[model samples]
Target: MSEALASLLTALADDELILGHRHSEWTGFAPHIEEDVAFSSIAQDEIGHAAALYSLLAQRSGGDADGLALGRDAAAYRHAVLCERPNRDWAYTLARHWVYDTADAIRLEALHDTADEDLRALVTKMSREERYHLIHADAWIERVAAGPVEGRMKLEDGLKEAFEEALGLFEPIEHEEKAVHEGYLPLPSSELARRFRELAANKLDELGVQTEIYSRSDEAAEFVASSSGDLIASGDEHAESQPERARGLGGRSGHHSDEFQDLWDVMTSTYRNNPGATW
Candidate 1:
């Protein structure tokens, strides 16, 4: 169970870590400068959250957190598919931001009740910070979905398209059940996906965006590979193939998007060359 708890923590942290990298890509590319500042803060928040979670996992794994985060091969990461998908547009990004924050909030709430006192306390701290993220995302979802012209349609479409991938956010990594058995993390792995989807449906409806919500098995197969342009392209294939290995052809299984490798190269370039030097 301790090992399972560690894997579960690593999986959750990796999603935040990769998605934070994706969010950082918009540092100067957002439609509005003020929004750029606001979104950038969120990116930093996610990265910080990832760092804190990774620190705990590193302690458990008996390795350095930096290596755990940046040195691992793509196939070793256990982030959800939604986090790795490129932020093609502001609307799509916000759709994911809104949904993921809500889902994360609920998950953290469950974690706050764990029998492991330290883990419960850490999750409690995270839940406090997550309130701000939820506010920002909810405001954007409501305003965009309720106002404007073409933007509303685009936001709606983005929500619908990403809903399934968002559901994939709750997918379990290796040994999640052990965490439950040991009470290191509350909430049964089997029911977490369903509860996450239900919360999403309620939030989307309240924000005036309607979409279907679904679930996948914790051990469902990997995403199908695209033979054409990027799988993120509008017409690209989404749910087709299934790989036998956990680190298969998709983002969740540790296989990352092309963007992930590129991002990691840049993120670590400076740190790797100047190791042991003060920043």
Candidate 2:
């Protein structure tokens, strides 16, 4: 595979691997037995998908799938920051789930047209399983939206909290232009991001939630997270009072938050401890 294609595959696999771990965190702690089983199953599926992608990469790049999945340093991971964030609450978890899975669906749809037959086939298989995930997330979204006022409020709050980081899911990867030129990626991340915003806006409108979450100002590109975690536009006078935003920045370039380090240590400890061991 070309370096660009390898980078793209690594990014895709890393997203699934990290988010799979997050989903697994809920295995025994979900609100109900059904949810516990549901999340566990989803986690399994995600990890399996990651494994499949890594296997393809390994075949093309002459690397080990296990090494690709578990042996990478934290700074080498290309997943969106959204995938690495702690699941703060069920509402947030569901919100992130909806955002990530919906975006994944869009991504896979675009990948379905790729010139690479192996990747296209894999995407087709993954999309079949992903359809159920979408159904699960959409059902919960609708349930929370139609439930009590408190539930609706929490759901909305969670969506607002996750919205921007979700946008980072489409942050352009390194050499993405080459990937597009090679037909490895049929659509650029920006176009995919636009489609996601439109789809999300329609869904939120249908749910009676505010569509303002999808609105982005030109200054949004200038906004960066401060040391204190608040987002401030460069040279803006009221930087101190600006709300926290853009936690999803720089993930495509492998810059991650402190939370990722903590998660990474726990996640890689096993592999690091038994470097050559096989399961």
Q: lDDT by residue for model 1 over 54-158, one digit each (tens)?
A: 888777678777877876766788787778777989988988888778778877878878876656777877787788999999898888878987889888777
Candidate 1, after superposition: displacement of residue 256 in Å? 3.2
- C-alpha lDDT of residue 229 in model 1: 18
lDDT of 2: 0.85
Could you give candidate 2's per-residue lDDT for residues 182-271 as a string of tens digits? Answer: 999899887887788778888989999876665642234354446653334456666667543455866777879999999999988899
lDDT of each: 0.70, 0.85
Q: Which 10 successive residues of model 1 have the least lDDT summed?
A: 228-237
Q: Which candidate leads in lDDT?
A: 2
For every candidate, C-alpha RMSD to the true structure in Å: 6.0, 4.3
What TM-score against the true fold does each predicted structure earn?
A: 0.81, 0.90
| Backbone clash count, each prediction separately | 0, 0
